[model samples]
Target: MTALHDKAKGKVNPVVAVGVEVDDAGNLDDVVLYRQQAPHTYKQVKYTVDSRSPLDTSYLTGPSKNGGPSILRKVADAWVALTRDGAPVELALVTNRASSPADQLLAGRDARTMLLMPAAAEQTRRSERGRLRATWAQATNLTEPQLLMLLNVLQFDTARDLRHLEETTSLLMLVNGLRGDHQAVRSGADWVAEQARYGHRKIDLEMIETAVRDQELRTGPARSVLSVATLKPDPLKTQAVHVLDWVDRFDGDDAFSKRRPRAPFTWQQLQADVEDIPHHLGAVPQVALTGSLRQATAFLIGATLRMVTNVDLAVTQRGQLWESAADYDQATHPILAEHSLGIGEDLALAVEVATPMTDDVLVFLRTQQVPVDRLVVLQPPRGAKDNAISTPAAAVALTVGLRDQARRSAKGHPRIHLFLAGPMGLSLLLGHRWNRVAPTTVYEEIRHSVQYEAAFTINA
Candidate 1:
């Protein structure tokens, strides 16, 4: 990346600071740094020296490697850095290693780590410790898609030897080459203890980039740090990653084994891990809309351009975009036309329950004559609370209604084109219901003041 952006010197954001040690301990293996451009947003960079050996997902998801509790300490340091100054804390992770394919590390199904989630939900009359408490988060086993969305790990080709010291013997080779001597340095402290000090600390992103490109260390997929962090819609998600990393670390520690962390617990780590991975690959979107979020409410936009199979999707709320069919116009219809996702589809469903945007979306569909019927719109009671879906009960009720409407509409329509506006919880709830549904396409409206910039095709 440094090499790719070398010509545009100022364009490349230099790492603010690189730590070779810890707060008060020995030399830490991991590194923590923030981009010069986006401060308060930090990421933990951990490097593993493989010594010419091929690397794999084990380095990231392994029990001993970054996947284990060892990541806890690194996350703790990052968390401290994030909260120490009281900045709008956001966390992301980047692991620079050589000889590994980015795809295998990210989408390799075999490498998926099964995270333990309580099989039950809160409000259940569960035991304190005897019955293993039913309030085990409103989630099931930690899935790969969920994990990647949460663990947005970015991998770059960086060799350990190159990062460590760049062959100390070459310490003098540059000077020798400069003098046309072509001789290697005899010794480190022998030749010139003070000479090494002259430029020993002189290093920059350009230098690293140049060297990396010259040596062909960059492999697999080539993506920039900024490329991975452009659209971090949610800061809290990153925090969740941090907290989970802490818990993952704490779960092994003897001191905090018996006691659990407080609310916003495991949130910090979770936020850090999931925020950045999507920009680089679209498969794992802007964190899966889980729990009771009406998945159709706040669209899920996954950008997996580089990946072979990236799901580009979006979900809208009922009242979020439009009121009734009257909202549709020549201007708004183009935005939907630009989406062109299910442009030539069999069916169009407006998730009217999530929000009131269905009317306009439906109008746009009908105006374009894209096969939308009266049953395309799915809405709730006229006077439902604005924040009605905050509860699981409300979301479930909406889902039940959607199932009925969708089943009735699916009788004739083959492909599903969805335009929605709803809450995040309802969107997530909608995500679960689509597992067995037809090929559904969704849309996210990146709106301007009075209009939208473009209609992003959200993959279902």
Candidate 2:
């Protein structure tokens, strides 16, 4: 009999069991046996038996494989050794006529009864496949939007099959092609406004209406909407829909009719501005410079000048990083712009701009998953050392250390190059990480004159 079957029977036969344990009830519970320990000439004579019972009783039968009669004889001998004068205490192995070979044969026969039942095997197969698909979806880069759409479709459906559901969800996602960010809407509006500049009679009436309604909802209605459509005659009108009748009347796409026109500066202009720094700084050396000190000096010189002289400078708060670029301008304009950089990419210095807070630039950069080789904050030059370095290098070192420490604490290891440069700082302050140490020039002064320019290579 199998060990499990023997354990279930509470019968520990020494000749057939290898190891054994008994429960508190003195019934055999578990067993392992010396299956072929005995020589072929006396195989049955040298077998072992062991068992444990649910009652915590233990029973171990020595190798006594001489046959059923021999096992019976050993049990009788053990029983005699433990019991005397009809005391009836449970300790020794005991044999009764009811626990014969017929009982063992019956248990063996009934074990296969459940195994022969139908559908159990098929159910297990289906459950395993389901578990595998769930694990795959979680491990893979399945997007939240895809998952949400799947859930949405599933919310109302007669066909709840998994294959059909996944396909349908994917189709819906492709059809949508992802919604545009607030920045995109703003850009589109600006584009529409520019298109209106051509004095074309065409207008995206729906877009204008949406924009107008949104603007009215945000600011007071008189600025955006023609009038409020109210259901109640009372002054305390609670139910109202903002109406933008004037939006459809615009037949032009120019700056006058559109909300926001083309960007004041083009990409070419920005790139030119970025490159013109060194040219403006001039060949005259303000002080001896090399390495990061030189880079930091150049960056600060350019950033500082800009911040001081430029009046149209925008200063976005630290929280703008969490928003879309379009929403960023709406929230705070002229100083800073914010947009997502995507997974695994750190935020890029898309536009060189000073934020509202001092650490805002550093904090935003470090939040990126990509490695940052250096952090150079360019502020407009000020009379009071607009570019002052907290010397002894401790403050700069602390800032760098804190940034790295935060990254490490979050388990996202990234190596960062840091520099703190103000009016009094030098390029060597940037250490070995500064790639360019060009001579300062007038262009540096002009570029740094704006408060919005950050100095760092984006890919770097």
Candidate 3:
């Protein structure tokens, strides 16, 4: 579907042919996409009905269930054979399984490139890196350098379920002026299966077009869903026909021990991911957002898909749905009570919606010696507490009031230090309405501590 989408979008040297079950001496030869004057991508698709098991380093390097070569060894051997002709090739392991949080080496794999990150690669003597190098070399029976070389071209395309893939393919068909209905999707799959059965290993663009025309598939509109999660999967994901998973990039065995992503870079990566949603879904008009995101991340997502964009958004907050296009009675909603402190060049804005955080924010400001000329606290009418703003209207109202306060109070300040202690929903609403303020620095509170760290500085 990705290849088809790229071709429809007129990608340079797009895939011209695809082969299924080709007689290649490699496990990755199940599916191969041939591009014009570019490296061909060989993919191995693995699907497990059990979602409990995740893909980890141990599983990848462990002996196959049938007692042949390990998964890693098969791919490594394939790489050696394919690259023998001095041609560049790409190998992919496409699976529905999630990545294991317990695997530190797997955690170092960059989500975008599917390659070992430079930072992670540099730590060769470190526990995870060293172990990865040793384990991979031993499993593949290859030298360290050879193992690294193979890994450079290896891609892990994980966390995509069958339903998601089907929906994506249907949507891609619609985008490419083909039928996108359920029947069309089933027909497409059946057609591929029939071709494979007949030993028609190679399929060209003409064959795909002919099949689509012969099947008489019709195009239709499609909606896309984006799921942004941290601690767990979002409940609203089940409501979507298909979902794009944007789980956290943190590495750890569990939520309590999860390692926070490095500031700025990880934040930027997340921003890039959110920004790419439109392109990924071929500019679907409506995008439903579901997630268990942190306040900062939620805010970032909202800011990236702000009100001015062509895409409309509907987000699930605390089990209630909030539509960006919904109309609300601004007068009936609760307004924030603001408190001001002594003035300075940099202003501190503390938005306390779920709980009180003024004291902690003040402590962090003073301890960190953040240059603050003034401080402004925006709280509920009574005060910050759990479930301060219950309704979507109230959430939007509070966000509007907070935005107004920030803009009015930040007139003389060059930068605003934003400290938020609130529901993720409120933060997202606030971010959607955030605009025309001074360069702002958003802070994330270090768990179990009063200290706050700068997570993202939004200059726009």
The top-ranked prediction according to lDDT is 3
TM-score of each: 0.30, 0.17, 0.53
**Model 2 per-residue lDDT at 374:** 39
292-408: candidate 1 lDDT, tens digit per residue? 111322233222221123332222233121101111112111011122334454666666543466446644564556654333555565522366454334454565456555655
Model 3 lDDT tens row, 1-460: 5455446545676888899988873788889988897589999888898898799887888898889889889888888888888989988888999888778777776764666645345565557768877888899999977877887888887888988787656545543445556777899999999999999998888887688668886443223456666644453443333354544565444555442563343756766666665555565566656655677777777777777666656565544445555567763333444444554469898888788887788777776667887678877776788977787677776777788778888898889899888887777777777788888888877564647768777764
Task: Output the TM-score of candidate 2.
Answer: 0.17
Q: Which stretches of candidate 2 lie over 4 Å from their true place?
A: 1-262, 266-268, 287-342, 345-392, 395-459
Q: What would you estimate as the lDDT of candidate 3?
A: 0.71
Model 2 C-alpha lDDT per residue in residues 306-365, reported as the tens digit of each score:
322321111111101110001211111112223333434222222122222334444544
| Pairs of residues clashing in candidate 3 | 179-218, 343-373, 344-373, 344-374
How good is model 3 by TM-score? 0.53
Rate residue 221 of model 3 by lDDT: 27
Error of 3 at 18 (Å): 1.0
Every candidate's lDDT: 0.35, 0.26, 0.71
